[model samples]
Target: MMNRRKFLQGAGALGGLMIVKPSVAFSYAANSTVQYALLGCGKRGTSVATSFAKNTQARIVALGDIFPDQLAKGKQHFDEINASLGFPAIDDKMTFHGWEAY
Candidate 1:
């Protein structure tokens, strides 16, 4: 039988746990990936974004580069990564190039 004393103790424990809350509770849906954008999309950017994709639940959705060739390469690299991870390839609209890309 849960008496008043036991009930109070249980409530106190629960209250203590409630007080210790998460710093930020991310409200992400189940099986949903985090959207990631890579600026520059050079060797360093690809390396960092690749590590992020492999280590975290983030998927590179956008790539931006001043050089069109570099941007294409970046897209190919990320497309392969996404394919291997069972994610769809990045949309063409998300690929930005030219000097104005920042």
Candidate 2:
């Protein structure tokens, strides 16, 4: 029963709303206390997670890596990042290592 013009206008408005600003997305993410258990602590994962922490008010809750050394590195990295941002260092128990970590 809807006319073509009305449908097009409604679709346009819906599309506009879908184009959310980056800040809004980050703001919502910032308030989340949801645990993020990263499966891998490799370069790609580290880079993406690092950027999110560095560029926004978001925090990393949990971290995991197959290798103990890499897990330590990730924990250290995020701990420093958190400290610089005035957030607390990640607790030792929050860092998980070994293949079973994932």
Candidate 3:
């Protein structure tokens, strides 16, 4: 029963609402905790994870890698960085290896 003009107007209003700044509704507090997971433990993955660990307010909670050695290496890398920041060490239980890790 709706005409094209009304439908277009409603859609435009909805689009405007969606585009509104998110900061108007929410603010990130300093102590807020953000947890992240890295799926690949390769060179690129480890590099990116290291960057996040060193620069952000985020914590690497879970790590997944197809190779055990790579997983262990990645975990150690993040563990050392997080330790320096006084963050709790990543728990071994959160690490996953092998194909099923994905």
In terms of TM-score, the best-performing candidate is 1
Name the runs in model 2 displaced over 4 angstroms. 1-35
Q: Which residue window of length 10 is worst by lDDT in model 2? A: 26-35
Superposed model 3: Cα runs more than 4 Å off = 1-31
Give the per-residue lDDT of model 1 (tens digit) for 5-75. Answer: 99999999978767563442344455566897999988888999999998899889999999999999999
TM-score of each: 0.72, 0.63, 0.68
Return whichever of 1 and 2 wins on TM-score.
1
True-structure lDDT of candidate 2? 0.80
lDDT of candidate model 3 versus the reference: 0.86
lDDT of each: 0.88, 0.80, 0.86
Candidate 2, after superposition: displacement of residue 24 in Å? 15
lDDT of 3 by residue, 1-102 (tens): 999999999999989867676554355454477899999989998888888878888888889999999989988888888889988878999999988997
Model 2: what TM-score? 0.63
State model 1's lDDT: 0.88
Best-first order by lDDT: 1, 3, 2
Candidate 1 positional error at 43, Å: 1.0
Candidate topping lDDT? 1
Full candidate order by TM-score, most accurate first = 1, 3, 2
